[model samples]
Target: MLCGKSLVNNFYKYKRKVWQNVIPIIKRHNATYHPPKILFFGTDNFSLPSLQALHRNCSDRLGVVTSFKSPANCVRSYAEKEKLPLKKWPIEPSDCSQFDLGVVVSFGHMIPANIINGFPNGMINVHASLLPKWRGAAPIMYAIMKGDASTGVSIMKIEPHRFDIGAILAQREVVIKPDVFMPELHASLALLGADLLVDTVNNVQERLKEAKLQDNTNASYAPKITNKLTEVVWSELSAFDIYTRYRALFGYKNLTTSFLGKQVQLLELRIPERELLVQEPGTFKYQKQRKSLLIGCAQDSQLEILQLRVEGRKPMNAQDFNNGFLKGARSLNFTQNKLSAN
Candidate 1:
């Protein structure tokens, strides 16, 4: 009923339903445009693309501030290669105040209020998920694990104490395909964020004014990835659910299960179209002609093993692994391997 006149306002309200591409807040910045002196913060490959974008756009990039802990990585290497001035974090607010604006990406440290307010233009973050959702460490991984249809990068101005809860300047989404994995999604978002960041920085003043407040009510946290979360519980979660998590956390956190008395990396898990007779969940069934291992799961789903890595060994085709390891065995239980170890 009220969507026409206040579409912008309504888009802010119903952010999830609408593919709201928050068009640049068009307003005249009658004053001459001066490229901002940006203080860039980042620590890894995820932050590299955005840093490169800033360097290409802004002439006076103050320096790179990265984690002292993650030194000698991509950010440091890139800075040295390009001869961009670089410094380690735990830097003083007064020092950060020198720059006209602060840009952060994949920099794990929280910028204190003084540093955030230090920049005359303001500090901005290029986050991997849409604001008010997946607002934590591993948004990309969580989005895939949770089986979200789509997720996007968010550009938002920073505030004290609260993390990722700020006025969103811009957002651009990427659709999740049925078979998308970690590296593909990560690279896509990194590039998308870099491009979006360039557009936002080119019009800092208008974006600040147009930045919309995030709805706290709809906010969801993507807690940091942990070892425990990577352990596959075949009986508790269905084949599809486990497959999705395997897709999401593969590179960073290998989905592992003790199989045949060895820790095996589940590189790929896919549910076949044809259903099989009911069997105990987590029991493996070998098909000689197909050269595949069919693992029964909840909801009558069976996981076809495509790829895997045996502990202390390189990844290989699951068929080869089945022939080599399974031998004459038809099926094995998850607990079978665990019990043997104990």
Candidate 2:
């Protein structure tokens, strides 16, 4: 038994470990039922765990269906490892009809209506957000990018028409922390979705009655993320806002902030505890003595740029980047590329 001091220490130490322990919950569901004859539809790492959970817990699997896309070839590796049947895209309705059920997780493509009707039980999807919210591609990143305080995973029956517009089967909510980045959040939700998926399969008959129709009235779409959204309009955003955006977008994609037309790639940044004087937003202020870089934002907040890449230069830390260009400069006008030697 942990004493008071050790108890507090363990709590801090295992706080993240606690989240990592969701695999057991999935394992528990395995024993309760025979594996459903599932045809899994997925292509990326996000779908990997759910397929694994199904392979472990459920038997009589039909196979895995995937596109031969790069960057998300985990499905193929997994199928080979498990010695499971693997089928590529343009799948026919006949292929889907052989399974007792269908499961989709981050599959990134729609299951056609012909395939939908083939399953006697129809299809179930493990979506990363609660129904009617973040109901599209890129839910994990969008939740963080929009600064949502809490987001969740939802297991829903698939509608033939679209993605994530179905009735809710189950949901598990997680609070967002300022420090949690996109990859961390993505991983957590994947495991959570797996747990929910197995539970939904076991309780589908009973759970369907409890399934709530989504309130389309409150629906907000999380559009697919592209390079265009990576553009940081510094003057229009707050430090806190940009910080959240950067956190969500950085690990998985490039984050570039441009002034007028010139782009600067940010390798890293941090929000410090110290406050700065109010200044016009988007002003870059550097301290030569302290070897610091501070950029002003809305609400008088400051963003400390720790690492950045100027054009025609390699990435550098604040102390190093300041050496040649920003040593004596106080403030630089980003638009005109003018130094405040005035």
Candidate 3:
């Protein structure tokens, strides 16, 4: 039989073990007990997930600040529907001081120093690309265009005037699948940014304490997409290059070239499984049996163009295009240069 003192000692040991196991769970619960007051700056559908997450997890999401160009006013519409406070862009400094932190995602404007200073914890941005790489408005598009094998999201401090040069608070990487297109990549990165943003916000002060300054020297930029990028240079671009560019611009823009003096938009492109006989780049061979158009490209590569649209006409499959446009021409070729009207 145990003595009273032994019984007391055994009870204390059991109590200590139970507390050891319970303390971490209690700490985790307490960590989120007091949600911070947050002012969210965002625009576009890409920013929606993060906003929704913060609203669901935090009690004090003060309001949303967005630009006039909110991609069909998606963010604004969501804010209004949810009855969340919504403010137009160029938020006043006077109104910002009450927030504990500012979270910016795809906001499209640089927050002024005064506005950033207004928040007790300053402002942090959720960028779509890994810091020091593809830092700008169209990171996802650029990542696809450049054939990057991997891309990611970064939670960083927002510096005035400059963009994507902020100190990184956290980063998360994702693989770029060979066949992934713009919308898929964009959605993946958006969700990743949202997940990382929530974690950073939950322990923002500690994260800020350990923030790492970005290495500007090693940085690369992803500028806005322009029409000029859609023009395909068949001679200079490989099948992979054209296909990747098509994937990158999918749903945003179409790969365009000049076909027999007419503007032709390559609607659907693919890398051909088998190589074609060495031919001059920009020249195409219509495979009547397969109903596919094979365009010669750099380094003996060939691109299979399945769908296309001639300027002033509706989109059509290769078979229809060949039957109507080709008219049984012996040799047909595409060119990058738009021919001058005679």
Candidate 4:
């Protein structure tokens, strides 16, 4: 027979043994076992989803860090609205030393070595593309422009001096629907990135331990969008190429060309099923039934110009444009001008 004190001692020993075995399992699988203190860095609307996710998952969110070059920084607005702490860029290393980790999304600034070393767990970035593929400032734009079949989000460590050259901690891929345009794709990728970021940060240590280096041989770049890409080279680009460019540049810039000695912007465009009678690229014929302009393009392809705006004029539908400007004009042509013809 066991004494009372002896029985209590045995029971405690058994409980301790059980817990010791279970603790490792719990830590391995539990996402919120020990939420890390996070310092978030972001500036644009694209960064909002990640910050919002971290706030929901982490109880120890320290603050937001951003260098606000634009007047409309959504991250700054969000931190203010939430009454969370906010720190401008170029923060001192000592200030963020207490934080366990740093999260960057669309921050657009190179973090210094001292600042990256402040966090005990180091910094991770939520990039909008599957890294090594489109690694630069405008991954989303280039992905849409290049008409890739698929794209995804990448969670990676932040290496100093370079943009997006980091070991990937995690990644999640999404399909690019055939008819999907830039704004829709951008929104979808942003939300997907946010979810992946939360999951990665939840088990960051394990993810970091299992990080994989990107294959530079298979790497590609997405340079910043420029005004030159918006120009419509009618003689050089196929109708499909023009339509793809329009889809990619939607909500960013419209395709521009010179029409009848004036600069004209192609606002709304569609791919035409049947070719027009005109064979020369850039020539157009107004389709009476369709209420659109069938414009010739390279490789015998044709595009429907649904809406356009001539220089110093309000945007008009194809019907209105034809009625107002193309009255009695059939063989009007769009030209590649050497200078601004406005």
**Weakest lDDT window of 10 consecutive positions for candidate 3:** 333-342
lDDT score, residue 323, model 3? 87
* Candidate 2 lDDT score at position 211: 79
- On residues 163-278, what C-alpha lDDT tens digit does candidate 4 reach at each position? 89999999999988878898899888889999999899888999999999999999999988877778777888998888988998899888888877778889999986665675
- Please write out the lDDT profile of model 3 over residues 1-342, one tens digit for every residue: 469889999999999999999999999988857667888988888999999889887855558888776368778888888988888888799778778999999988878999998988999999999989998889999999999999999999988889999899999999999999999999988998988899999899899999999888899999999878888888888889989999999999888898767798889888867776666898887888768988889888888889999999999999998889788665598987573221
Q: Which residue pairs clash within candidate 1?
A: none
Give stretches of model 4 more than 4 Å off.
1-32, 276-278, 328-331, 337-342
Ranking by lDDT: 3, 4, 1, 2
Provide the overall lDDT of each model, using Cα atoms, as 2-decimal numbers: 0.82, 0.79, 0.87, 0.87
What TM-score does candidate 2 reach? 0.83
Candidate 1 TM-score versus the reference: 0.84
Weakest 10 consecutive residues of candidate 4 by summed lDDT: 333-342
Q: Write the per-residue lDDT of candidate 1 for residues 64-114, one digit (tens) a residue.
A: 987767546798888888888888787888877668899999988878888
lDDT of 4: 0.87
Global CA lDDT computed for model 3: 0.87
Tens digits of per-residue lDDT for model 2, 1-342 = 559889899898798687668767778765555655888998888899898888877744549988886744998888877889889886988997778788888888877888988988888899888768888888889999998999989998898878888888788999988789999999999998988888888777777778789999999989888777766666777888888888888677766765434467777878877786555766777666555678877777788788888777788887886676665654464432212111
Worst 10 residues of 1 by lDDT: 22-31
Instruction: Pick the winner on TM-score between candidates 1 and 3.
Output: 3
- Each candidate structure's count of clashing pairs: 0, 2, 0, 0
Candidate 1 off by > 4 Å? 1-32, 276-278, 312-316, 327-331, 336-342
